[model samples]
Target: MSESKNIEVSGSVMDGMAEKGGVLESPTKKPPTEYTVYPIRWLVLFIFVLYSASNSMQWIQYSIIQDAVVKYYGVSSITVYWTSMIYMITYIPLIFPASWLLDKTGLRVTTIIGSFGTCAGAWLKVFSVPQDMFWLGFAGQTVVAISQVFILNVPPRLAAVWFGADQVSSACSIGVFGNQLGVALGFLLPPMLVRAQGTVDEIAADFRLMFYLVAGFTSVLFVFILLFFKAAPPSSPSAAADLGSSLDSNFLQSIKKLLTNRNYILLLISYGLNVGVFYALSTLLNQVVLTYYPGANEDAGRIGLVIVVAGMAGSVLCGLVLDKTHRFKETTLAVYVASVVGMLIFTFTLDCGVIGVVYLSSIILGFFMTGYLPVGFEFASEVTYPEPEGTTSGILNAVVQVFGIVLTLTYERMLESVGDRWSNVGLCILLAVGAAITAAIQPDLRRQAAQHKG
Candidate 1:
């Protein structure tokens, strides 16, 4: 391949050096040696993941204290729900802009912007705690939701920029795992901190404290990202790192190209369906539990906690397997099938009146459903090689957000009309469709080999 063609295909054209024949020297000139920049890359990744966790923790905060929030603000359930729902809704319009920003700027600038937005939103919520200021809380959530557009698009990009080829999938998984861990913390913490049985005044006090804690944590993360996160290493860590070239070149063309790729589109839809269902489930778990098992709000939180924890574990395991075996297609398909089974088990066990069975089913459901995320994310990046990671990931997330909003609204209506048991049945059908679609995704392993060889 001509040097420019190679740069176009691999997305790694170095600046100015391409004019010297090629940015990467021919193998005969000097064998590529992987650069090991100890501690710095890992430290940057840690800060990014922490920021992701904080964003998620803020997103799910109101949901965890759902009843208390509604009572405290004297608002309807729909109003309280909008705090979380707005996050997905905002992504619909903002994700493309977020992607463009990530591609035009670099990881540091994009992430710092996002971190600051999250910090500002968190503190805004703290101010919203006094009097009839529900609107302030909504305003804060809207800002945080906008920040999510930037934060969610960068994990795969960060992993590609910082980690070696062999570790890329694993690293991506860790980045994703941090978001899920924050979600798990979101589920576990709020219920414990803001007691359901407390008087309205007492509940409001606890809710205020929760907001303060999240705001403080997010401020600390913002400071850390500002101080430490680097855009990319001084030298490329792997051939995949060369793909960073695409981040700066042909942003519009890359979007057009991604839309036209067959595998990328299929993976986009399949991944969206699976993740949309996961988002719906996460957002509505408290309602789902309370619907069938009336007055079991705490149990709902417990179930959510188990699902998120199990899902995080599943994400790490899937990432490790992908790193070792490069079995993206197979792993994704298997996880989809597992999710279907778990969904079936959970749906059937919902009203069995046995708490143990319900918990077990939820754990199983979470492990597989949540587990499919990293595999799907990495697979999308692999199939759409040479595209900016932010662009590909941004499109993926945008699609998932669209699906999430539609499904969450649809399922909420179904929960009222069809009841929780049948509402879950609908989710199962969606999971099965997602699995069938996943089966059609043929990963371009040749592209994988070429990326590694570069």
Candidate 2:
């Protein structure tokens, strides 16, 4: 691996370097200090999990019920998807600013901003439930989308601050699990609660009820954040955790440095394409199913739920595998390529008119497709070992959203002009390119190298 640029995040100290023991020490080489893992970390993690799930639920809340939302909002299906697209749009510009806020303000202030934004957004949507208030709903969604910027980059910071080095990856996975679970509920709950076969007033009532449920849930989590979330523990959780970021590395400089790295750039390309396609597929999945199945809106949501639920399992399994194997490049390449295969199967199966096969193929697609998330995070961290995990991850996510916008547009265009079958074929070809890129990268596990030397 190339030498890690000495960039700091959240103002971590840059003076100390990792020694042979894998513990960073001061230049004076003071004797090791005690690091304690507080039980409160679980409470912190739990609240964050729910909070993340709540915010993410809003991301796909409407899209999963595309037919119903289009009618209730008196808008086009693309307009309904735009409700979800607002998330990608907001995330791109706000991620760095959010990272900077977390760095400057510590956990409490950041949590305040994220939690309030989430709760407020959820409730604000209630006011937009009336047919003419689509713009108002969009505004509320934009608020929640902005809050995600504060939330998505938090897992690494949380893990570093609260977990031992040995457990960082697992901690990160669990945090990500919250976000995935939220997406699952986004796919599952809205379809069940909101009615597709109802009068406009009846559908509006369903939307109102669903929005209230989410808003109530979000409000409770916001209170939990106020009561429990600490900025940091009284003591660090591990020796490595103790050696933290300083007010170094200008945010723009860090972005430039990350963009300049060839390996990291390749990662951005591969990860971005994989995630972008996943996002587009998830957003438009219902339309693809409806085109074939016709009026099976509930089953459309169920298919999406299967994809996400399968993805959650795949994510957990991959985390366990990487923990045991530490095979960053090999693991990522295998999963990335498999996702393409999964997509290929799903494409051919979608038009076969066999809903059962479609379900099975979704399981395969979701498993590797969503499974690649943590793998990408881990690989990027390895190659850019000493760079701030928060910044690297933030940039990585930003790239994914960029691809999300592009591919979602392309997929929608093709789905309209070419057909659902070929639109997915397009995704398969794109992911194949990503897989080849993944294969070409030289594996660098500098973080692990430092750990082994310890």
The top-ranked prediction according to TM-score is: 1
Instruction: Tell me the tens digit of each residue's lDDT in model 2 across 211-244.
Output: 9999999999888899888787666655445444
**TM-score of candidate 1 against the unseen true structure:** 0.91
Q: State TM-scores per candidate.
A: 0.91, 0.90
lDDT of 1 by residue, 326-374 (tens): 9888998999999999999999998888778889998899899998888
The C-alpha stretches of model 1 lying farther than 4 A from their native spots are 1-37, 243-248
lDDT of 1: 0.82
The reply for model 2, stretches above 4 Å from the true place, is: 1-35, 246-249
The Cα error of candidate 1 at residue 376, in Å, is 0.8
Model 2 error, position 367 (Å): 1.0
